[model samples]
Each structure stands twice: as C-alpha cells, then as structure tokens.
Target chain A: MISIRNLTKRFDGNTVWENVNLEIQKGETVVIIGGSGGGKSTLLRCINRLVEPDSGEVVIDGVNILSPGTDINAVRRKMGMVYQHFNLFSHLSVLENIILAPMKVAGRSREDAVAEAKQLLARVGMAGRENTNPADLSGGQKQRVASARTLAMHPEIILFDEPTSALDPTMVDEVESVIRSLSEDGITGVIVTHDLQFARRIATRVVFLADKGICEEGTPEQLFDHPTKLQTQRFLYRSRMFEQDLSPETLDLYALASELRAFLRRYEHERKQEKLLPVLCDELLYPVLKHPEAPAAGASLRLLCSETSSRHTMMIGFRGIDSDPLEEPYLDELNLALLNNYAEFVLSRKKDDGWEVCIQM
Target chain B: MTIQKTLQGSALTVAPEGRLDTITSPQLESELRADMNSVTDLVFDLANLTYISSAGLRVLLSAQKAMNKKGTMVLRNVKPEIMEIFEITGFSSILTIE
Candidate 1:
C-alpha cells in the first residue's frame, strides 16, 4: 500500500528523479530498476524520508508519508530496511542487534522483543548464531542477522537497498533466501536495486528510476528485452546501472548467466552420476507405486512401474526432484490427500505381477 | 531444496534443483530475493523441473516484481509440458518465459 506521485529529487544541479509517479498495492512487491545514479535508492529513502526529495509526494496506505511534520521515526520503523553492507552493531550480540531497534523504536518490552528476535533470527537463517558477535559471523550470517534486526521492527513495508552488494557470489544465496521468505509472508516491499536478475526471478513488477526520476515502470521482461529508453537498454546490456546524484544501483547479468550455466552444468554432471532409481529389496515394484509422490514418469520410473517383481527404492528420478525442498511439507500433504482420495484404488503391489488387493493395514 | 549461487561481480545466478512449490517457494524466495542490489539479470533453467503449480507461479510473480525494478528475469528451456501449464494458467501473460 504505497504510492508515489510526480516524485523528483536532485543534488545540486544533477537530478536523480524527476516527475516520478508510482503505485504499489498491498502485498505487491514493486521493484525500482535503474543504473547507478538513477535514484532508485533515493526513491525508497524518500518514502521513509531517509532522503527527502526536492518535490513530489509519497503516500503510504493513503497517508501522505512525504509531507512535512510527518513522524520520520515512525515512518522509518514501518519500513524494515536491509542494507547491502550488513549493518549489524559490531559490539552487540546478534540477539541485541535485532532486539534493540524494535524495543527502543517500537517501544516493545525487552522480553517480548528478545523472544521475537529469537524467532526472527532463526527465520533469517541464524538459528544457532544468536550469541555470536558480528565480527565472528560469516558474511551470509551477518546479513541474516541484519535481516532479523529489520524484522524486529515489525515494519509494514520492507525496503531492500542492494542488500547483497557486499557479499561474495557464494555467500549471496543464503542472504537471498532470507528475503525470499519475507515476501511470502505477504510483506509489502519496494526493492530499489540494480540486480535485474534477482528482481526478474523474485519481483512481481519492476519500476525504473531514470530519465530524471522514477521514469519508466513495467514487468522485468519489458524493461530488459524491450526497454522504453536507450538509457535503460544501455544499462541493461552492461548489466550495470548507476546514478551519481543518487544511490548507485546495478550489476552484471552476463556474468551471472555464466555462473548459472556453470552451476547447472555441474547439475547435469551430477545427474549423470546419480543413480536413477533406488532398488527396493525383497518387495514388489507394484507396491511402491502406491507412494503418490513417486516419479511415475521417467523411463526408469516406467520400467519400475511396469515391472512386476520390483522392490526397495529411494524417492529419486521424479521430475519434481528439481523442485525446491521448502515444498517438501506441502508435497507430503498432497501425498496424504492422494492417499485419502484414492485409498481403495491405491494399494501396495505384490512381490510379483499383481497388487495386494486385500490388505487392510 | 538446495540452491547454489554462483556470482561474478554484481550479477548473481542461482541453480535450484528440487520442486519450487508452496513449501519450497520459501527457499526460492530466500535465495533469489536478496540479489536485488547486486544482480541485474536472472535466469531459471527448468530443464529438470517435472512439476509446477500455482504456488510456484506466485514465487515467479514475486521474482518478476523484484527484477522488474532493475533488469529482467527469464525462464529458459522450460519443459514443453510445463510451458503448457503456464499457457493454460495464463501465467505466460504475466511472466517472461523464454
């Protein structure tokens, strides 16, 4: 529930955003895309008043957030922000960093804040790291703690300002995973970033801050493949976007594609090396088919399903094998539903040639 | 689900193998959403995917929004059948699938 109208910003004579108008619906994540100096981050700052714009208005859930006299601290608290630099307080324990803001700014009790901090820390992938100091933590761990700290504030909207900019390629995934979880909770977001790949894969709509200010907006595909402006296209081709007057935002897509290619290439190798099916010992093949999540479709799967005396197996070779494991529980639930719906038709197979037609348990 | 991120500079690439559905959408969400600052292009190669549902669709929507802010997100080599599902559900309209 955020809206921006004719928003503009400039430092000296250089303009970051000009006549930038945008809207973000509740639970809808809107990404602002542009190169460095395009004012992507400035746009977000304007919303929270982190960087006051020269002109234009920011409306949050119908409240004109950019108005003078608005509560800046309150506005800041409502939008949890995760910075790229992993802004955890070095002196404090991980737990304190998360609890401090919420307890102080939100006026939450120490006990309650701590309890919530613990839950959030775990959610942000630092379950066992609460007592650790930032100096002792890994880059990924540090960023997660920062995210937990942001969550502590219980903001209505979360703003990500290139949260992974400082991370190594490998370490970025862990942090990325945390943000992904935040969106599913239906937290409204305004992510100002130059990482088009991240936005493409994770965002719902992409907004561009360019040609003066929040200039163009569209889906990731529209901006990347058929950008409305040459500047947008140039930034896209370089995979680097930035603005000197505003916060810099941009990255490299080609390098990312190569990395992905290499990783997926490795997957192919692993797939080739991996055993296609698990051999079930002593049992019949038909019986295993009763498992609803069973692959049911590969050549190997077909062979097992067609064979009469097949036995002992691992749940492998299914197409869903590539699916994210976070869905495991839901898959389990779906399996249960299948069991409930077709209990009678579904049966364990005999060690040979047929189904166990009469077994009750 | 295990997702490995291979990055060069600001660009980030993720290889997630395993179902990306309601349960696992969280992991995909976690793994892909953070690169908003450093990554400009995103590609999801679904050559291994065998199952996809609306839950998966929602994650794609979220990612698209995230990337839309900066660059672009493309789904490449989606299985023909999975592509059919996208077509059937009209997700093809909202997402940029290659």
Candidate 2:
C-alpha cells in the first residue's frame, strides 16, 4: 500500500503539482490521466524518489521513504519504472538485459537470475527473444524486454510512464496486453498515460490530475463515461480526440449517432438532468454530422462526442484522404457560417493523411 | 451493394441497395459514369442504403459536379442515416436531396 499526503513538486520555480494526496491500495492499478506537462509523470517519479518532491510525505506501507536516512535505493527496488522510451541497454542481449538487474541489484547468482529472467521473458511473451539484442528488436519487443527486466527485480509496484506512447500503433496493443496481464496477476501499478482506452481497460481506479492536484478520481467507468468535474471532462474529451486523430477509422453514421445518444443518456443520468437528449442531438450532434469532406475510398472519418452540463465537445477526425476537403473554396464560407452560428469555437487542423475538425459548444 | 436502374424519358434512376462505403462507391461511380452522358436528370434512389462513408460522399460529389454542367442530380428517399452523412459533409447544400 502507498499513501501520498500533501505531495508537492516544483521544477526551476514552476510548480508541477502541489498538495496532491492520494492512496494506492495494494494490487490496485491507478492510472493518472491529464494533459501534457501536468505532472502525471512527475507524480510517478516522486513516488520512487526519482524526482525528489519539494515537500510532503510519500509513505509506502507506513514507511516514509522521503525522510532523511531512508534507503532510497531500497525503496526504489520495491518500485520498477518502465519509461516512455524503452530504456534498455542496447549493447545487452534480451537475456542479459533481464538478468542484469536481478544479479547485480538483488545479488542473485547468474544461474538463478538467468532462470528467473527466462520465466519473466516468457511471462511478458518474449520467450524466444532471449538472444536478440535490444537494437535488433522492435519498439514493442524492446519494451517487453524492459518490462521483463523490471519484473526480474520482482518489484511489488510497477510504475509505467507512457510505456505505449513510443510504440507504433500496431505494437501498442501488445505492450498493453502485457500491462493488462500484470494487473490480473495482482501487481500494484501506477500508470501515467494519455491512453484513455488503455486506462479504461486496465485501471482499477482513474485519477485526473489538473490545476496542481487531483481534480477527480473514480472507477474508469465513472470517470470516463460521466466525469463530474469540468477538468476531467475536458481532459477526457481532448484525450479521445487525440486518440481518434492517431488511428482514424470509418464509422457508421447511424451507429455513431446511437453511441453518442447512449453516451449522452448516461451522462444525463449521472448529472441527474431531464430532457437533455433532444437538445444535444439537435444542437451539437446534428451540426457536427453536417461538416462536409470528400475522402477517397478506404479513407475514414472518426467522431468523438463528450458533454458536460454547460458545454459540449465534438471531434471529427478525417484520415487516409487524398486531398484536404477544408481546402475547397466552396466550403470556406459555409464552414465559417456554421461555426459562427452553432459552435462557440471551431478548430480544424491538418493531420497525417487528412484533417481534424473540433467543434465545442 | 445491388444496383437497379430504371430509365424514363431523359431521367435515369440508379437505386443502390446496402451500404455505400469505401469498397462499394466505385461500383456506383462506374455505373453512373456509363450512363451519365445520356441522362439529363440523374436521380439516386437511396431508400435501401443503410450507410454512407466519406468514400461514398466523394463519388456523390463527383456526380454532382458532372451533373451541374449537363443535368440535374437529385437524391430521393434519403435515409436519415445517409442524410446525416450528407449534412455532416456539407453535401446536402451541394447535392439536391428530396
């Protein structure tokens, strides 16, 4: 069990987060979700004393590791961190990578470390990659080896700092699956990531960090589907938009509308509102569905909708298109008029293959 | 998708059944291209169309552009779902939907 009481941190006079109090129960997978540079990773680092906190206590199992005379290395040994970039020794083979920590840090014999490393590699689904060098392996494979190395330490808690962010889209699921398996095995995990879908799948609890501390914390369903706080809702909405932009896919219009309606109904239920559906559909959903972009075959238009009591956010992402539809001269006036009338703000940006239009009302 | 054609006077009606997605849009495009020159009025009967993606919209845009010079293009019995696609892409204003 880890308890953070009034944990605060600052970097070169800029406060990252202040007075952040949170409790990670044993075996609970707590995911920290927030905007970039909001101290999500810093909170993880502070827990392991990698970035020393400005003030406050980081107590793990009644031991205040931040106190003077505390064995910081021993405390760190209890927490394993998997970085955004696979911080593996490129010169070391996969087997060597995993065994190095156990043999040197834990003082285990090379044979014993090798045996454990093999098992950890197998557990992380990298059994046959023992002889492969880190440079020779793919990003996902290297991350797997990194995870295996962390597991080699047999830490009670694993801190993941955007482990899948550096991976290719195709390889993200593989690493995520590995992390999911760890949660199933009852490992206490503190994951700081922008991957909301992954967090929803693996997190036992979700913490939204904003404005110097935790703005909201709840179960993934509660936080994602119906976030009570404004910051939580905005962060979730933006995070989903980013995810859509990265891997856009063609969506059935009817199915998407149905999903949006269902989401709105759930949101209304959480907010205890009556008669919000009709207004949302007519005002927000209808206008968003009206934007025109001519995408080539196999291209996709992805949509995401999120609403709070006072405002609504709709994100439409277009990908794999041959030409930018927003560049069409005929659409300039119409898009401007639509934005002026229906949305409080309309932001459109060029993406990899297509464009993204975000409408907030 | 199954396409049914009915010719009356100078109008040619192409009725497409099922989804007009990325895979099927070209089928509709080629079908229209073959007869578009002869027809003065182009009508798309979308009663049975269950879905339309950006791919489908592109074909429709091209058809509308072509018809603007020589003929009048109209989309009839447009499903709310398909209509939403038109509305989303600003195709409703460009293409006459009834």
Relative to the true structure, how large is the alpha-carbon lDDT of every model? 0.61, 0.74
Clashing pairs in 2: A289-B88, A290-B87, A290-B88, A291-B88, A291-B89, A292-B89
lDDT of 2 by residue, A192-253 (tens): 98767778988899999999899999999999999999888777665232122222234343
**lDDT for residue B68 in candidate 2, whole number 0-100:** 90
Per-residue error for A80 in candidate 1, Å, reads 1.2
Using DockQ, give the best candidate's number.
Answer: 2
| Ten contiguous residues minimizing lDDT sum, candidate 1 chain B | B16-25
Please identify model 2 stretches exceeding 4 Å from their true place: A239-299, A303-361, B1-98
Quote model 2's TM-score.
Answer: 0.56
- TM-score for each model: 0.51, 0.56
